[model samples]
Target: MKTADPALQAMLRERNLRIIMPIASILAALGLWEFLVWYNDVPHYLIPAPSLIAKTLIQDWATLAQSAWFTVKLTLLSLSLAIAGGVLLGMLFALSRTVEISLFPFAVILQVTPVVAIAPLILIYVESTFWALLICAWIVAFFPILSNTAIGLRSADHNLRDMFRLYQATPWQRLRYLLIPSALPYFMAALKIAGGLALIGAVVAEFVAGTAGQNTGLASRILESSFRNEIPRMFAALFLVSVLGIIIFLTTSWLSRAVLGHWHESEIKREL
Candidate 1:
């Protein structure tokens, strides 16, 4: 049999380690935490063991699942809105200097202002709690996309731009062929950032809205558990939120790789 190439074997080992290391670390940490808690006879109410949190998650799955679904819906809806608004506004800004100058400060203001500070005011104004939460999440997720897209659109090579102009390319052709491609990498990066922000905003908005009932999200569950001093349940809800965020991140990363892996340096895999 032919010997395996050493470089390929090294690459495979590296890839395996990348996957193994994080999982090993997480398991080790949890084991240590469980041991210390059991050894010290720690109260579950103060810091429940990971196993107890997992048990709470299973026992409360029905209630927790519904709330998780609500949170997922809220996060996705707000992110969708943010993408639509941010892309359109970014394009307009890239195409018009006056528009950028006029509107960018307002975007900055929205980003700098804490969502919690304005969430109460938004709830007071918006008749529907869902809409209010959505607006808050949108505000949190919109700025990064807008800024990145605008910058990316403007980042196309001037030489390529001049060539397009020399060829008398139509506006649509220039946009479709040149501007969009240049902006895609930046936009993908922003998507990862905005995805997490959207979830955080939804949770924070729900915390402020404090809407209770069948339609409420994970944040409401966390708040209720906190109020009742059901620490394990609170931890369970938090664990779900963390998992949801990780899912969003992984999905966005996969999408970025799918879209850019063949051409973009950022996504292309290279042997170490």
Candidate 2:
């Protein structure tokens, strides 16, 4: 058998070390969690053991899974709409200083406004809870994308801008070539941020407005479990939500690397 080079072996060892630490950390935390519950003899209602949480999750898999699906659907839908709308608005802002100055204050207002505070009024005005939830999530998710993308669009090299103008590039061409590429990294970063915000918004809205249609989300289930003092089930749902958020964050982060890998400094760090 051919021996691996020392440098390659060292790199492999380092990679494995990096992977092991997080896994070790998680296991240690879970072990500590289990110990605390056992040590305190914590009541099941107060703090369910990890074993109980797993059992509850399995026992209620059907209902929990359905609710999980609903929450995922709402999150995905809201994120899609936010990305589409935010990118367009960001472009508008980047292209016209006056338009940006006029409209940005409202965006800021939307950003600063708490979804919990807004959900009730939105539910009152909007005939359907679904629409209201969508709006609320969009409100929370859109601003980062819009603001980051606007900054990115404006970040294109001034020389390139001058060249485009000299070439008599059409507005669309300028946007497609100069602005879009320049803005992509910022947009992806915004997307990563927005993914978590979208989930939070959906859950918060559901918590406030309750469920509308046949499909109630995990947030509703969480609230229900909390009210009834179903501690294990609550922990299970909360765990799933936490998992979902982590997955979104990691997935977006991966996508950002995949798309901007060739151009961005963040991705290039690995090369050095």
Which model scores highest in lDDT? Answer: 1
Model 2 deviation from the true structure expressed as Cα RMSD, one decimal place: 1.6
Identify the runs in model 1 with alpha carbons over 4 angstroms from their true place.
none
Candidate 2 regions off by >4 Å?
A: 211-214, 270-272
Clashes of 2: 0
In order, the Cα lDDT scores of the candidates are 0.96, 0.91
lDDT of 2 by residue, 1-272 (tens): 99999989989998999999999998998889999999989999988988899999999999999999988989999999999999889988988999999999999999999989998999999997888888999899999999998999999999999999999999999988988898888898899999999999988999998755677889888888988989899999999999889999999999999999887986765644
Backbone clashes for every candidate come to 0, 0
For candidate 1, write residues 155-268 as lDDT tens digits: 999999999999999999999999999999999999999999999999999999995556899999999999999999999999999999999999999999999999999998
Worst 10 residues of 2 by lDDT: 263-272
Candidate 2, position 234, lDDT: 92
Cα shift from native, residue 230, model 1 (Å): 0.4
Clashing pairs in 2: none
